[model samples]
Target: MDELITVRFFGMVAEKLGKQELVLENPGNSDRLLEHLNENYPDLKEIKFSLAVNKKLCTEPSIIPIGAEVAILPPFSGG
Candidate 1:
């Protein structure tokens, strides 16, 4: 069965995706999710950001759990 993950984007990520959040269907794998994202938004390949699952930063995209909340955080700037 396919699972749906909620992806939340922040800062530039949100701007690039044109939405604050997105619902994606996956098979409970981070790599698969990345593939979906890369396939859907080829432009995202040029941008750098971090993918967090359930508020925790993850290095391997396959760490995301099914039906978990994913957050995309871009580089932050402060003065």
Candidate 2:
């Protein structure tokens, strides 16, 4: 069995995914996860978003442990 990772999608990303969260198998690192997602959901490639692992924003690719908490945050506009 593959390792399952819990991933949360916020704002537009969630809407695009049609679910607030997803369980992925062996997502590997942040970059690998992006690649897996992009391969599965090509639309994600065009949507600008930030990735977070274990509640911490990740600007660069990093390892994602099994069952780790991940989230994808879309661009925000605020006053």
Q: How close is every model to the real structure, measured as TM-score?
A: 0.84, 0.88
**Winner by TM-score:** 2
The alpha-carbon RMSD values of the candidates against the true structure, listed in the order shown, are 2.0, 1.9
lDDT of 2 by residue, 24-46 (tens): 78668998889888998787887
TM-score of candidate 1 against the unseen true structure: 0.84
Error of 2 at 30 (Å): 1.0
**What is the C-alpha local distance difference test score of candidate 2?**
0.86
Per-prediction tally of clashes: 2, 0
At residue 47, what lDDT does model 1 achieve?
86
Error of 2 at 63 (Å): 0.3
The local distance difference test score of each candidate is 0.80, 0.86
Model 1 misplaced stretches (Cα beyond 4 Å): none
Clashing pairs in 2: none
